[model samples]
Target chain A: MSAQISFRNLTLGYERHPAVHHLSGEVKQGALLAICGANGAGKSTLLKGIGGALKPLGGSIDRHGLDPREIAYLPQGAEIDRSFPIHVYDMVSMGLWRRAGLFGGIGRADRTKIEHAIAAVGLEGFETRPIGTLSGGQMQRTLFARLLLQDARVILLDEPFTALDAKTVSDLVDLVRRWHGEKRTVIAVLHDFDLVRATFPETLLLARTPVAWGPTAEALGPENLLKARRLGESWRDDALPCSDAA
Target chain B: MSLFDTFFAPFAEFEFMRRALAGVFALSLGAGPVGAFLMLRRMSLTGDAMAHAILPGAAIGFLFAGLNLYAMTAGGLAAGLLVAVGAGVVARATGMKEDASLAAFYLISLALGVLIVSLRGSNVDLLHVLFGTVLGIDDATLMLIAGITTVTLLTLAVVWRPLVLECVDPTFLASVSRSGGVSHIAFLSLVVLNLVGGFHALGTLLSVGLMMLPAATARFFVRDLTALVTTSTLIAFGSGVAGLLVSYHLGTPSGPSIILVAGLAYAGAVILGPIGGLAGRFVPRRHLEA
Candidate 1:
């Protein structure tokens, strides 16, 4: 299968200070990849670079044949404002944003799709409830419903299971499996090594740079995990800028 | 005097009162929705900043046109847009918070506006500019306010979807489409336009009062965006009517009276509103137990 996404010597960071440095990798079509790392691992930064939310400070992120709109990105829950007065249905329907756009009407077919997505996430009666009234798990479910509606070729999930209840995590993990089964490229930043080992077929352990890559079992070995922790600990604010060469 | 006579007679008898009422009512219609969005985005104070940002522009217009409505409106729009866009750019480029940059710019703009107005116009003219001349509203100014209100409402309708998305989840909006940036700029422009409109009716210092007070009040009453906007507009309109009546009867300043009435409504909602109100807090945790 062709690579759906390729990062070549990519360095992404804020203010010329690299969070992710000289990372080179390819995500094959329909690959289910979990990115694991300790705190300050640049896992989220990698996702942001690929999702085109942040520009590459050095190098490039090539989106093979996929258009920018063909990718769906779910940022961390902290990035979303739950206090805003928005209905669950309305927020979920925003997944169709690329298709319906600013002024486009949501046709009956789209409405049906939206409804199906909401029902699929076990939020059947939450259509009219304001998002602020929802619990964290319910809100995550609503966001997943939105992602389902996105129906994109590449889906990037940043810390998808953080702070979620076990039931909600398992249910959303099932959806992720379903997406992989549907032959979509899925990349997620995860902290749970046990969950990654049990589910993800491929894993990338990163700490500012690639520590290991390949099958989950081989990539997440004890040595590589320890190295990732060491790399994170040694990272300093005044560290020398990373060069383009990997 | 009868209640009807006290409330209706002022508007019925005087052309100026009727015009003032119509001007502020239109202001309420547009300002309420924009203000609700501002509050939702946590940019309520940005509205205040933008209000001050328009002052130097309006004062420049006064200098050039000598109280000409068109000149002042155009100038205010220009200045307001400049400050808003400038603040946004500075925030993005330098990593400073938008509100901080907006504050810096607005304070400078305020000083410049006062200095410019004082250089050309008298203290009386300055008071008129700062406090507004709602009772003295002419047909041209009235038409301008109505026109701005119409444009604001229509633009809001067109950008409503993206605007809500941008407010609630800007990162998601950015991922989905390119219109997120467009929606933000368009929303800020609408805010500037409405502030200019309200400035004519309520003064630059108090224009945000008409937009933000009713919005803050409505939040206490409604959980849905549609209900919040509708309730806000109603509250603003009611405040306009009540403020006009009070001003007419007591011979108080119209603009301040209008804002004061809105403030009073906000206080009432905070105390007695069903949602998150102080009184609601006292209603007990029986449901929590259940």
Candidate 2:
């Protein structure tokens, strides 16, 4: 398969302290890739770099043919402010931002897509409810509906299933599978190993640097997992910078 | 006195009261929506800070033009924009929180403004700048207030979608389009412009009260953006009229009376409103169950 995204000696960090260092890999077209690591292992940071939310500290990220607007990124739930007075339908309609834009009217066809997306997420009757009034599961479903409407060729999810109940997880995992079936490139930062092993065909294990990459079973082997944990534990905040020439 | 004599008579009989009514009505039309966005964005205190930031420019205007409406308005707008942009820069460059930077800048503005006003102008001029001369508004000032209201409403409508997107999910907005930063700057400009308009009618200190109190009160009673803006405007207008009547009867200061009435409205909404009020705690909320 052709590469959808290629990272060459990429480094991403804050204040020049790399969270993801010297990462070189390619996410193939129509692949479901899971990024797994311990806390502070740069999973989310890597996703952010790919989503164009943050600039790389060093190296380059090449998107083969996809434009930046064709990528949909779902940030961690904690990053969103739910208390803002917005209806679930209005929030979901924001997925059409690329096509409709800020001032463009949502035509009848777009409205139908929005309604269908909402129903697909089992949130049909909750369309007009304020986002603040929804439960955690319901809110996640609402966001999933939005993602459905986004219909991006590349979807990046940052800890999408964290704090969700089992049923919600199963439902959202189904959606992720549907994305896979549609031949979209999907990259997700995930913590739960069982879920990742079961759902994602490709796995990248990282601990500030790539420990293993390739098929899920080999990349997440016991030896590689131990190496990742050791690397993560030995990391020092004030360590000297690694030589770029090396 | 009958209801007509108490409420309607003062506005009908006195030209000053009539002008004050027109001035506040115009102020509410713009300030209401602006303030609703402020509350939604959790920038209520930023609104307060920007209100103080306009002081030095209006003070400078007073020094040059001796209470000239056009001069004060222009000066206030300049000063407000300066502080807004300056605070944003400081926050970005230094990684300081925007609120901390805004507070620092506004404090300096307030001090400089007071010093400039007290340096040359009389106490009465300071009182007019600080408390406003709502009862003393002339045709020129009234027209300026109305003109600002028109501009504010139009600009708000134009930037409405992006601004709402910015407030709800800013990262999402940034991902989809380049209008996120533009929308933010535009929203801040609207806040400053409305504050400038409000300063002419209610003075710097109480102007934010006219904006924030009604907006906050409206939030307690409504769960949608349209309803919030509409309710806030109605609250502000009602407070303006009631405050004028109370001032007419009780011989209180007009601007303070108007703000006091708005404060009272907020308190009443907190107690009696259906959404999240004290009364709402006792009564089971049905709408939130979905």
Candidate maximizing TM-score: 1
Query: For residues B54-93, could you state the per-residue lDDT of candidate 2 as single tens digits?
Result: 9888888878888888898999999898888888778866
What CAPRI grade goes to candidate 2?
medium
lDDT of 1 at B184: 78
Number of the top candidate by DockQ? 1
CAPRI tier of model 1: high
Give the whole-model CA lDDT for all candidates, comma-separated: 0.89, 0.88
Q: Report per-prediction Cα RMSD to one decimal.
A: 1.9, 2.2
What is candidate 2's fraction of native contacts?
0.61
